[model samples]
Target chain A: MKSHTYTLRVEFGDCDPAQIVWFPNFFRWVDAASRHFFVQCGLPDWKTTERERGILGTPLADTQAKFLRPASYGDVLQIESHVSEWRRRSFVMKHQIRRADVVLVEITEVRVFARRKGDGSDPHAIESVAVPEDWRAMCE
Target chain B: MKSHTYTLRVEFGDCDPAQIVWFPNFFRWVDAASRHFFVQCGLPDWKTTERERGILGTPLADTQAKFLRPASYGDVLQIESHVSEWRRRSFVMKHQIRRADVVLVEITEVRVFARRKGDGSDPHAIESVAVPEDWRAMCE
Candidate 1:
């Protein structure tokens, strides 16, 4: 799988009073990474798909994470993200956070189909729309 | 609506390449707030339920957010969370991230039932075990 790399510097707002990276901050990085990767790779702008679909396009069905080490303030970290599985009804992505030579965190976020066009009642609808061919091609 | 507060410090890990709070980090902060509010108010532990139920306890069903101001590293942000509504098998919660008096971001997270504890396969089950009586009283 082709993993995309995104890097950013830690600012004062990303840490805790302990001066280490706050745990919630990790999800933020993954979110940004996903958005950037999709946008860069050209996939109908995943961010705005919700409006087009008339429903919330992104919904997390499940996620599991492990904290390998503490990320401190002022550190430059890299986030590597890739599709762990791209299924017909849903998709799973894995993200890794690292600094220099060390890995700080690993997270798996599973997203499911929610509110289809015009209605929010569908329970995990297998999207009738196929995953964009160009998007899949980029993963290749 | 009564709101609960959760205080967190920013870590370098939560920032963008520009050292601003990454978007996904907002989810983390709101989640922390949810966990803290539930636990502090004596609600059942989500982790424990997941173990007993063999199902993922909490999943984000829908989330919409607006970024007001950027949060920087080392800033202490307070997250205020409150239940917007409690309906059959679903609920809405509102969150605001603030640095002292300034609002950094606002979000609405809607969560629904993933599976039933008795049988994890019945994804159709949509029910909340009634907010504990004590929790209702506390909220009242």
Candidate 2:
């Protein structure tokens, strides 16, 4: 229900010729912040999991992002994400992108389906399954 | 069956602490390439629609990326995207991540739904909607 926020600086590639953050790159910042949250909560990032167990998973389903202000290259930004809702079917995570403490973008990503263990044909239907106990134990 | 590719130099922020390209960043790169495709087709990126016309929509389905190699900072990479399938109800986009001629990732995005504008209560459904004439008319 609350958030974990992290800070990162916008690099040159994160911006465009206009010297502002490229629109699509917002997802990168959100994903990086989300990864930080997962690691902090004990879920290994994809790379770590692949190295240790040869398994990986990522968000599937839907997403929406709204840009409120322009972020320039070299700006120090803060990203925050929290479990906004948890249902038997799925969970919702909300993220906010800000520059120098000013809000820049608001995002909500709904991750429902996940595939693991290098399987392409079969997807683990998380909606029909219960949240892993570890998820509840960490961000609670 | 053809692709429109975009070239960009990798930056540290695009990688993980291990100095390899992060998974989510691959999605960002493909999206940037998609915008490039739109430009080539004579359409403005969606941000222009959102900011200039208030006609905003976003993908509401799933996107998946398969990572084949590590991409590091200072490496100039190319992302290729093309319409692999355009059916009556939905479409599919295929993406390739490459460094010079070496392929690094292959991705496909299937959009099941879309959030559209000008509806009274909720966003409009997007099943079977036609790709705009100008956009589709571009290679004609």
Highest-scoring model, DockQ: 2
lDDT of 2 by residue, B91-123 (tens): 577778888888877777654212243452332
DockQ of each: 0.07, 0.08
TM-score of chain B of 2: 0.76
- Candidate 1 chain A, which ten residues in sequence have the lowest lDDT sum? A118-127
Candidate 1 residue spans exceeding 4 A from truth: A47-57, A113-116, A119-134, B1-140
Interface RMSD of each: 14.2, 9.8
**lDDT accuracy of residue B130 in candidate 2:** 45
Index of the highest-lDDT prediction:
1
- Tens-digit lDDT track of model 1 for A6-101: 999988788644345655667767877876766666655533665675333444545666665566667899999888888875678888888988
How is the predicted docking of candidate 2 categorized under the CAPRI scheme? incorrect
- Lowest lDDT 10-residue stretch of candidate 1 chain B: B122-131
Clashes of 2: 0
